[model samples]
Target: MLVNGFYSVVSWIFLALTVFAGVALVMAAIAREDAYRAASKNTKQFWLIILGVAFAIMLLVPMMFLQIIAVIAAIVFMVDVRPALRQVSGKGGGRRGSSSDGPYGPYNGGR
Candidate 1:
């Protein structure tokens, strides 16, 4: 009985983390293609943490196949989108621009 209760609690925690990571991933995707540091770095960490948490949870509770699948999906997102975003954002080095420009706008050309 005690072991069952412990696993139940763990399952709930994993479920909550899964939901949070999934939502964060969606928000990051929506904010993609932007040169903003917050969006870029956040998106990168979001996937990394997602995969990490998913793996940890799966290791702890191998019965949760859905979590495994979520990790796979996150891996795909990380590989497919993260590199292009990092290239644009320059390794989270940050860019500067006036308020008139958009969030991800390019710097002035010194014209």
Candidate 2:
């Protein structure tokens, strides 16, 4: 009844947290080591270990306390470190464009 439905909701929430941590781990791995230094963040290896443990805790640990701790680590990486790395490395996303540049390229008026 209501208990079953509550458990189902909790399961889905855990699933989402697991997936988020996994994705953060991959992102941390992809960034270059130098980028982290340039961004004044922890070394890439450190973040990888944190995120890796978080992912593992989600899968192997049944304790909600550990899962919450892991989730917090992943969220910090996503919110703080990820943005700094992207800004330093310019590889967080796809092609970049200058402020004046249009969809294709810089547009000039008839001159």
Candidate 3:
């Protein structure tokens, strides 16, 4: 019974990680291809293939070690590559304004 309970928890954890990879896959697809080059990151296709495989591993393979490896790939993409892509595309790094910046965006005084 204890083993069954532990197994259920483990299954849910893997499912959540798989979902995370899936979300990362979608986000990677949405990003512009040029952004990857501008950010000096790998091509978008490369990330797509890695993340797609990561998303698939949890579904097609039951090996915990492989799933963990895939999750690491997804994490790298999410934490490192995505931010660089966003910065290159002018969609990240928060507001780009002086100290008078407002919540919405830059708060430029009337010229």
Candidate 4:
């Protein structure tokens, strides 16, 4: 009974990590290519491949070593790359009094 309970907890943890990795992969894909270059990070294509492989490993293998690598990659992208990309692309960082226009056009501030 105790062993089964422990395995259940472990399984939940693994699932959470896998989901996190998947979210990171999708974010990397949807971000602008030029933003990646402007951020001076790895090319969008390179990160796409890396995150895709990491997500695959999380989904297919679920081995500890591979999962750790995937999680690390996701963390690096989220913590370092995403923020830099956002800054370079003028999306975030809370700049005040900036134009409300988006890259393509202006919205009425969402209504």
Candidate 5:
């Protein structure tokens, strides 16, 4: 009984994480154009895999593969992509704005 309850709780937690991750991935795809360009194929594939596995688990599998993939993507973002993006944007204590563009404001990268 106790073990079953624990498993139930764990499953729900994983489900929530999976949903949040899916939403974040979608939002990142929308907002971060540079990231979109940098990892266009990988980003699309990642979203498809994560969301497909999430729907499969929610509707069919009950195995939580989506959560696993999401966790892996989160780790990659934190360790690899974040640092690379910081360097690319010159935000690693280097500069507030780069020669290419700034924080997607009204400046328009014109002058």
Candidate 6:
């Protein structure tokens, strides 16, 4: 009984890791290519390939070693690359002219 319980917990953990990796992969795919270049990070295609491999490994191999590597790749992309891309792409809420700027207009305060 105890062994089976431990296996179940391990399975859940693996499943969660796989899902997280999948999310990271999708985010990498959706991000703009120019943003990656502006952020001075790896090209979007490079990251896409890395994340793609990580996701595939996570799905195909349930081994702890491989999962750890995949999780690390996902975490690196989420923590480092994603934030950089967001900053370069102006999607990080960096506060532009103002709400009245109309995305590319002159601001007039509250007028």
Clashes of each: 0, 0, 0, 0, 0, 0
Q: Candidate 5 clashing pairs? A: none
Candidate 6: tens digits of C-alpha lDDT, residues 10-78: 889988989999999999999998999999997999999999999999999867798799899999999
Candidate 1 segments whose C-alpha is farther than 4 A from its true place:
33-63, 78-80, 90-111
Please provide, for model 5 over 1-111, each residue's C-alpha lDDT reduced to its tens digit, 9 standing for 90 to 100.
Answer: 999999999878876766665564554454354653464325544655655455454445455465465466655554565555455555555445656564664466455
Give the alpha-carbon lDDT of every model.
0.59, 0.93, 0.91, 0.90, 0.56, 0.91
For candidate 4, write residues 30-75 as lDDT tens digits.
8999999888998999999999999999999857998899899999
Model 1 Cα displacement at 109 (Å)?
A: 32
Q: For candidate 3, what is the lDDT?
A: 0.91
| Backbone clashes (count) for model 5 | 0
TM-score per candidate, chains pooled: 0.38, 0.82, 0.83, 0.82, 0.44, 0.81
Tens digit of lDDT per residue, candidate 3, span 4-75?
999999888978898999999999999999999999888999999999999899779988899899999999
Which should have the higher lDDT, number 4 or number 5?
4
Q: Which stretches of candidate 5 lie over 4 Å from their true place?
A: 35-60, 64-67, 86-111
Candidate 2 lDDT (Cα, whole model)?
0.93
Candidate 4, superposed: residue stretches over 4 Å from native: 95-111
**Could you tell me which 10 consecutive residues in candidate 6 have the lowest summed lDDT?**
93-102
Identify the leading candidate in terms of TM-score.
3
Number of residue pairs clashing in candidate 3, backbone atoms closer than 3 angstroms, sequence gap of 3 or more or interchain:
0
Q: Could you tell which candidate, 3 or 4, scores higher by lDDT?
A: 3
lDDT of 6 at 71: 94
